[model samples]
Target: MPSKADADAAPPLPEPLRVPVADSHTHLDMQSGTVEEGLAKAASVGVTTVVQVGCDIRGSRWAAETAAAYEGVWATVALHPNEAPRIVHGDPDGWSRQGARQGGGDAALDDALAEIDRLAALPQVRGVGETGLDYFRTGPEGKEAQEKSFRAHIEMAKRHGKALVIHDRDAHNDVLRILKEEGAPERTVFHCYSGDAEMARICAENGYFMSFAGNVTFKNAQPLRDALAVAPLELVLVETDAPYLTPAPYRGRPNAPYLIPLTLRAMAEVKGVSEDVLATAVSANTARAFGY
Candidate 1:
């Protein structure tokens, strides 16, 4: 797991924005704070909608339940690519699906995908990921399994007609290649987009949404900022990816949806637009991405 700063060191919330926006991606289920507290803080700072994304079966279920209970919240369900190989090697029997016991690595993956599919069908689950290539973490032995799982997620998203929220980390080529091979969903978003200007142009050509996270504000993230500059406003969105990737001046601290204004403002600065205009465009793009 990545190191985080002391929670006590978290920065105070920034000023609320004149125009509200949606956090296109977040992990509310992993936060130390209660969902109510997180949502309240977010609303207080003009973040009116949040799409809570899940990276595993348990988290996916929790995301769906949280979305059901919260009016301004929505859910996206999927297993992380790293989680796929773990399911294949770990206790397959440790999990069950539709009252049936899984017996092996493949069985375990199948069961997990089955459960993810079931969760994706839920009314409040508007997306089918946080699923994609992650070469930064997974090794060669796991890559095959990860690709298999990713392809399955692509199919699931299409079947459900929901957004495909991708988690691409150091494997942009494979992520795009697999999406092309399997054919992407109508609404596909590269969550916490880390690609460069060229990749951003490709995404623009494909009509894929690019959801920028706090990392875009880092001093060394010129490539990401370049991507943001080149990406059209209609295809751009903003997020906290919270409890992680807090924006500059507070990079090590825990992040929350309430802190989104900081990232949004940074994006506006990158695109040379007013915050209000950027915020409005981001919110509309987010709604289109998730169909919310």
Candidate 2:
């Protein structure tokens, strides 16, 4: 959920860029503004493409529908790691977050994954993720279910020939282990990349994409910048992960796709390259990752 302090309005849009870029992962559905407003704001600032990511079954369906209705937008379908435990245990509170009913048990998990599989076949759905382990939000009780769901999504992405967008938080080793064991999809991205330079080296060796988000702009995020520095330019991507992880100088304020430039500029500085050069590289990387 978004913080209360940053819920009212969006920040001013940054100056438009000559080179266009794509936001590799975002949850427009969870943001403060309407979908059209969000899209317009992004376009006005030259963030021409967006990949709307879903956190659960209902959200995945909505993402696919939104992609079908809008241009310059794509969808990624998945049952988030935190959301997986709720499905396995039939937890009412967790189900409520996704607007799903309780009592369905393991069958519900199967049904949800089946829907995700169906959605993966859509032309507008280009990735399978925001799916990976979340040790911070989900504890030991939920880890097994999360792993099962992660492996399932991995297979789905491979079968559909789409990118795999991972959401790893404090479970980097496990995430890598699972991917190796399951044979990762052709294009794998670590969304909101939360790893060190060594981890970046590991990803680079494996031909995976590392997507840096607004959090990378924080003064305390030196490790993230370090990771960006070591990442191969061809294997790098950028995203807003909007409505959360707003960039510096606007850390407590709302974030939108329009604000992507703030993070991108920060990334360019860290990588010791001009923003335009980094932007062009990131845009091409995103296109290849999602096949857009």
Q: Which stretches of candidate 1 lie over 4 Å from their true place?
A: 1-7, 91-103
lDDT of 2 by residue, 143-242 (tens): 9889989999999999999999999999999999999999989999999999999999999999999999999989899999999999999999999888
Clashing pairs in 2: none
TM-score of each: 0.94, 0.95
Which predicted model would earn the best lDDT?
2
Q: Relative to the true structure, how large is the alpha-carbon lDDT of every model?
A: 0.90, 0.91
Q: Best TM-score goes to which candidate?
A: 2
Angstrom error of the Cα, residue 122, model 2: value is 0.6
Candidate 1 worst ten-residue window by lDDT: 92-101
Tens digit per residue, CA lDDT, model 1, 1-292: 4344454466798999999899989998777678999899899999999999998887898999999999999999998888888787764443444222355487778888999999999989999999998999988999988999999999999999999999999999999999899999999999999999999999999999999999999999999999999999999999989889999878888788999999999999999999999998998899888887
| Ten-residue stretch with the least lDDT total in model 2 | 96-105
Q: Residue 101, candidate 1: how far off, in angstroms?
A: 5.0
